[model samples]
Target: MPEIKRQHGKQLFLITNTKQNCAFYRKNKFQQFSHKIHLLNRQPLENWSFVRTLS
Candidate 1:
């Protein structure tokens, strides 16, 4: 992740469905960027987008 930040100097974006993992990222300073429902194989799933800015 640091490598990406060093290369881009932009906010990091992540998408995931695991609640536990998302909570972990939130605790570590990532902010909730978005929340949406995504369809996968004809079923709807809750997804979260997180962002971390590098200074």
Candidate 2:
């Protein structure tokens, strides 16, 4: 049951993250996309792993 609950929570997180990403893209368009990617590449390994899961 705990494992199932954890999985559900992860699903919820992904859904919310996706929605936020959509809104961000709409607001920023493609102009900031490259900049964001550059920033992401420069992020530390730990932070990069978390960001990779979103994509």
Largest TM-score belongs to which candidate? 1
Candidate 1, residues 1-55, lDDT tens digits: the string is 7898779767787888888889898997899988899889989988899998877
lDDT, candidate 1, equals: 0.86
In order, the Cα lDDT scores of the candidates are 0.86, 0.31
Report RMSD (Å) for each prediction in the order shown: 1.8, 11.3
Backbone clash numbers for all candidates listed: 0, 0
Residue 25 CA displacement from its true place in model 2, Å: 0.4
User: lDDT of model 1 at residue 47?
Assistant: 89
| TM-scores for every candidate against the unseen true structure | 0.75, 0.21
Specify the poorest-scoring 10-residue window by lDDT in model 1.
Answer: 4-13
Clashing pairs in 1: none
Model 2: residues with Cα > 4 Å off, grouped in runs = 1-17, 30-55
